[model samples]
Target: MAGYRPAVLVGRWGEEAQLQEERVRDFMRRRERGELLIQKIKSLQESLLQKTELSVCKDGCVHFGDTVLLLNPAPAEPGPGACGSLALAVPLEDSSAYSAAPLRAPCGVSAVQGVDPVGRNTFHVLSVDGTAVDEPIRFGQKFGLGTTGGFSAQMFYLASDHKSFLRFATKSHLQQVFLTEERSYLTCWKAAFWDPQLRLEHEGFPVPANSKIIITHCHTNRSLAVPRNFWTRSYFGKEYEVVCHTYLDSHKAEEDKNCWEIVTGDPSNRDGSMCDRPDPQPGGVRKELCEEA
Candidate 1:
């Protein structure tokens, strides 16, 4: 039987300072107050865990439990690349530890650092004395104790029902893209590359309508991508030869007219996908594009 190796990983990121300290005090106070406080904490935990979902995964990735998988290189050559699997587990969760009580949900003390639903996955919070044991929750035993403190609780997760899968396109790669903008939303990556250039050649990409493409020079960490075209101004345009324009300049709010135009060569075409549309001197800085590295 394929068995699962017990691994633990923490997901505490972007937590504030004061809140962390306060949560620590709360846990310590409860622990010192004996059974009454402990029971209260357990009740709270139960309520939350009942509302939260759990999941599990066999794939060795940076999952809630598994930190990362170590891949080994093959000797000289073989099959595709060369590989094996090494399982790694990191610290579960961290927070301000108090002398009175061990912080249970320390990682969830803040708005940003709290426990988040990783969609649908099997996740179980097992009671750890020294090793991993899968015991059912009951009265007496410290089995599946939830971190939230509802009754005696344990942490657990399950694979999400909304699983994501990958798909390959029939085309070899992507080159030129089409963008459309409307009143409420925007669009990007409407079209795929028919013929790619030297830079975009063989570069395959997911054609999510209005896919954002990051354009950058050599340095800088800013990124900018045009949204897909829809109905802008009174004019219907293909792709913005430029970006960042006010919609009020064209026509009436409900007027269905194509007021502005930005034309450029299709890069995948035997021609260059360079923007040849007239400069936006009279319109706006809708063209000279820049993005993050």
Candidate 2:
């Protein structure tokens, strides 16, 4: 993990404020444009489906642009239902044919703080426990939880001060209750990271096209590289680290390690094995592994 340095607002207070405002306006303009491109891409996808005479199921199908199809077997399917896989559809003669159009803000919708133009939702900074968290959600700034917990949970508010940061509650610190005010930044090493790249193939959204973003917190001072391990808790409360070799062969393990490194800055163990590391904190015993890292 590497530290993120925020852009400083230089000059006198008034001048700095004006500069910040301009930066925010520019960001909103770009975001609006991105949203419009996404919309056009979605429309193109629907057109492709219609032309191919293939109807996307309300469930169990994933669409990407206008040429990809990921299928997940329904539970009622014969044999193992979990063995869904990816398949390509409608290859284009020119890849550039699927290029998305530039986006424009919807008519009558002003770029306002705290509102998502595409989703039509108000921005709110929320705590892990669902309470409204207050902080200046400024553009190019990072906000972190100020606690003594081992997990790193922070959010970077990109391009706008009005959009709310949403924090999905996690059962990371089950032993203690986090005070609303004690939320600070976090820095940690040795965590599990799961990439469900194909899990959401069959889903529908209110918005024709959607994007999901995940945020990770790291130290603002130092960069750390650590190996990740998977762990499981037994019925008697003991925890055991899961070695990848036990389940995946050498070739798959190496491929997975490479992909994991690409997705997460952390590298897999040199031995190509997943193992547990001893905790330095007093009385801190490994109880469970995080599903998402």
TM-score, one value per model: 0.14, 0.16
lDDT of 1 by residue, 86-119 (tens): 1111112221112223233212111111122211
What would you estimate as the lDDT of candidate 1? 0.23
lDDT of 1 at 261: 10
Worst 10 residues of 2 by lDDT: 107-116
What are the Cα lDDT values of the candidates?
0.23, 0.23
Q: After superposing candidate 1, which stretches have Cα over 4 Å from the reference?
A: 1-29, 32-90, 93-202, 207-293
lDDT, residue 154, model 2: 30
C-alpha displacement of 77 in model 1, angstroms?
A: 7.9
Best model per TM-score? 2
Q: 1-293, model 2: which lDDT tens digit per residue?
A: 14534554445968878899999998788568754455644544444222221212232211211111111112223243232211111112211123552111110111111111111111112233232333222212333322111112432111111111342112221111112322334312111222234324422221121112112233322111111122223221212111111122344321221111111000232211111123444475434433332
